[model samples]
Target: MTIVLGFEGSANKIGVGIIQDGKVLSNPRRTYITPPGQGFMPSDTARHHRSCILDVLQEALEEAQIKPQDVNCVAYTKGPGMGAPLLSVAIVARTVSQLWKKPLLGVNHCIGHIEMGRLITGAENPTVLYVSGGNTQVISYSEHRYRIFGETIDIAVGNCLDRFARVLKISNDPSPGYNIEQMAKKGKKFVELPYTVKGMDVSFSGILSYIENSVEPNMLQEGQFSCLIDRLLLGGQETLFSMLVEITERAMAHCGSQEVLIVGGVGCNVRLQEMMAVMCKERGAKLFATDERFCIDNGAMIAQAGWEMFRSGQVTQLEDSWITQRYRTDEVEVTWRD
Candidate 1:
């Protein structure tokens, strides 16, 4: 029985989780939320994570009913995130590994999401659509690697949504994306927005720019253009989500995959899930997804990926346990998968 404690502070969220074998023992997290019309800076995000990481770690351990000595390894998200936040979590992970005298594994943030999604949804060898605040990619496993089939040429889908939310001066308390989702539900009309899908890849920056330019100064004034704002929010979401679905379907067709699994933070969006489900039904495929618990960034994903890597004899030497901000999904070898 292998027990792993994982740390994840990739972006605005800090989390700690424990996993034993294939089961998640506990997962606890804290988010660093910025005010409306603002996005979180790396330094500020790191500070928030540093202030609450220990408390979250304690909560995780207590909830999991485990001791330091009982854990066999310590794992953390090593990359593809903000520099300050990644480094903050890496430092904690390294310190704890040394203190516990256990092996350390640096898990890729993307793979962590994929592994956790698979574990929770029981989907085997499915084509994955990973969409989040920092990344957007359509991936499928091939020859010991998670190969990217399609990706965003500019900003990610979630980033696009979050930025639009800021333009609307919406609350970023729970999340800009969540607020946008709620606003979109009330929209009864769809205004035409830029739909940029180039072959297998999608681009969201153009759409964002179009919407931003369309939002005249007068729209910002209180109680003015309320109906237009609603249409833009809903239209923007539908347009962006349609682009995602198009690329995902193309990837699935190319790979001949019958199962589709959506991972990462933005995967929690009900509209995205529904759109994918419709596409899946048309293609005669299965759509597998998880709720916020596993869909959003959390430590349990890192723990789950670490468990797989550790079981496969992968470990990080102390001197080489460094973090990177641009780690690619295809860079890591999928040793645990056949």
Candidate 2:
């Protein structure tokens, strides 16, 4: 029974977790919250992660009831995230590995989400819709790689939503996206926004720009604000998710797969899940999704993916371990999958 301790500070959230086999023992996370009108900057987010990581790590180990010496390996998210945050967590992970005399593994952030989803939901070979603040991709496993079937051409879905929330001066306490979701529920007026889908790829920058410029700032009447927010959320999500479902179905048709897995921060959206469910029901396919605990960025996913690599005889030397801000899902060689 091998145990892996994972660190994830891919973006605003700093996470620590312990995993054994395919099960998560403990997952603890903390997010950096700024003011209502401001967005999370990388430097500030990195500082937040650096300050809270040790506390998160200690709590994770205690919750798992394991000492650092009991850990067989230390894993950290290696890429496709903010540079400073990733570096902060990577340094801590390296120090832990050195102190504990355990091997280190560098896990791909996107693959971590996919592997964790599969482990939790038991979806063997499902088409994956990975959507987060920094990433948006339609992916599937083929020839030992998570091949990208479709992706975003510009800003990601979560980024667009969060940026819009910032324009509205919404509280970033829990999350800007969550506030948008809540505001969208009360929206009744349907305002048209640019829907850009070229082939398999989707673009959201135009939509965000349209919303920012066209929507008047002083239209905050009793029900007017809620109506506008709802319209934007419902309409924007409908357009975006439709493109996602279309591309995913096309990939499913090409691969002849009957299962779909939604894994990433945006995958926790109830409306997105509902749209996916309807699409899957029509195609007679299954849709697998985890709750916010795993869907949002967490260390358990990193631990799970790293453990898979570790079990497959993969290890990153201290000298070779590095972080990147632009690692793609297909760049990873999926050794554990057949």
Choose the strongest candidate by TM-score.
Answer: 1
Scored by lDDT, the top model is: 1
Task: Please give the lDDT score at residue 14 for candidate 2.
Answer: 93
Clash pairs for candidate 1 = none
Residue range 1-338, candidate 1, lDDT tens digits: 99999999999999999999999999999999888999999999999999999999999999999899999999999999999999999999999999989999999999999999999999999999999999999999999999999999999998998889888788998989888888798888788888999999998988888878877767877777567555678888999999999999999999999999999999999999999999999999999999999999999999999999999999999999999999999999999888
Off by over 4 Å in 2: 221-223
Residues 1-338 of candidate 2 have per-residue lDDT tens digits of 99999899999999998999988999999999999978888899999998999999999999999988889999999998999999989999999999899999999999999999999999999999999999999998999999998899998988988987777787897998878777777767666678888888888888888778756767655555666665576676667777778888888898898999999999998888888899899999999998899999999999999999999999999998899999989999999988
